[model samples]
Target: MEVLRIILTQSSANYKKEETILNKMTYPLPPFSTVIGAIHGACGYKEYHKMDISIQGKYDAMHKEPYRDYCFLNSIGEGDRGTLVKLNNKNFLSTGFDKVAEAKKQQGSSFREGTTIQVMNQELLTEYRELKDLLDRIKDFEENRVDKVLKLIKKRKKDLADKKKKVKENKEALNVVLIREKQIKELEKNINDRIKAYKVNEYEIPYSNFAILTTSLKYYEVLNNIELIIHIKSDKETLMDIKDNIYNLKSIGRSEDFVDIKDASIVEVVDTIDGPITSEYSAYIDYNLIKNECVFLKLGDKITANGTKYYINKDYVIEDNKRIFNKKKVVYTSEYVAEEGSENLHFDISSEKSYIVNFN
Candidate 1:
């Protein structure tokens, strides 16, 4: 089979695990999607394309390094509960109609997560009209949705009564009055928020206590001076396109980890490669596997993206609008056998299991 061999070298890189949240970790080999994403990045394609990809790489644990993680919490009405944290700065959240355009222009321009909270605050104010409108809405709800406010007001009154009971009868009334005032203010604010929500909720309440962006010291196991070999199995036209602009392809793993592309040539797949585990290959979407506890390797998986590690679980079909790739097979080893097979092959190695796939 004719194939386009693309050689890429990276000095330092980390393929983040899919489940990583807090601490960033690194995978030895790039995932199937990551490779395609990088290629698509260079090609500047709008949508995903269908193409067979073969990836094999050798990397060593260079060292553990720290990186800043950015997360975002969506506004109210979108959902309830915990905020959504983005491991990487995909885009900066901005406020105001003017800043919305500015934000779009600056999207992907910087890897850093900017002042999202500030932007959101600006958005909520909306020329201060929203605040006035919300106040008016709260009053309207008091007359309309009287039941909703009654329960809330009654709760506040009950709490106040309890507080008064706790205080000595002879104590100064000023403190009690101050407490009452504070409670009333809080009650009104809550009512305002609840009523505004009824009228098509707008901005998410960015309470400093609930919404938070924390920075902590974390480390990622960086793969230093690694080389990856990607075989592009596509038609002559696609091959020519890649050959022409292969150099334009950027880093495969992390953006900072630049890939040194070399040896772009047409080649043929040889026989089945039988070898011991010298290095690990990425588990792409294909190579089907059944749902069960399958012991593949002694080591766990690395996801430096959010600094987390998790083993593969369940079987899923890898497909988008443009492509339907392989159905991954379960394996007993950490590495995948990257060889051309006439038919899908599976075998057992003593107590271990392996799956080899062939793509025509």
Candidate 2:
């Protein structure tokens, strides 16, 4: 048996676990579909191409940081918003202040008379957008309100020209600004404290503010110069195609996250002294997994990044467009003897469904 092995390195990367919002997460290693997609992207195949592959990698270290981004989906440009309003005008209800005008004309002589009238109402319309977008707009409004209050406070503080004379005049505005500032500051400080706590405890932090958080954002965990190795086993033709394009692979996760491919080549396998069956070979066990050979983990059907399994199989199923584990099989790498222990698995064994595998 001949297998293609590829080694890749990435400085910083995010394999986002899309199921979580308000906070983002990453997988320990690229899943099967992500790997398949990267290969297809490099090979110029627009659709899924059947292949067999296994991935395992080690990162020097990783840390999470809050990232701000003004994403288009969450925001609207002025012109774009206006155009959308005009295009979707009919959906909104009429405001009470609309102006109504009526005109009537009467014509015709002795024998018969005809009367015609027309009524027109001019209205002000507001379009409906996503609830999130509406909240963003409200957030923007509050931010502006706070900014104005802050500026007023600054002006009042410097209104010391007449001392006693200006004191009473600026008193109300100064009081309003000071009160708002205190409220906003208190909220912001508490949020910051929560962020600090998350860092210390390793919990998911949140993004919210009394002031409009103008910046678009995401949460990311970074991996520094990590080594990623993948094992591929397929027919002669499929293997050849993978070999041709695997070298061209530039990324394994998001487009911006790139891979530094150090090696992409096929290796010859040596057989056992007793037989020609080969010392090592890839075997896939899926839907037909023995009753006690496999275990599936679900958080009451709620999907998450950690413990989400990825495996290799002949058929495929995609979950949330990112999870591509299709009843795939698990392989034993350490001893291959498959006794009762001392084997390395692509997935961290979570339960004792397979006694040969260990769990954390």
Candidate lDDT scores, in order, read 0.52, 0.47
For residues 258-320, write the lDDT of model 2, one tens digit per residue: 888887777643222231111122122122222243322223442221222334333467778
Candidate 2: which pairs clash? Answer: 69-216, 69-217
Work out the TM-score per prediction.
Answer: 0.49, 0.43
Q: Which stretches in model 2 have alpha-carbon errors above 4 Å?
A: 69-217, 269-360
After superposing candidate 1 on the true structure, give the runs of residues whose Cα lies further than 4 Å from its correct spot: 70-212, 271-327, 330-341, 344-360
**TM-score: which candidate is best?**
1
At residue 182, what lDDT does model 1 achieve?
A: 83
| Positional deviation of residue 54's Cα in model 1 after best superposition, in angstroms | 1.2
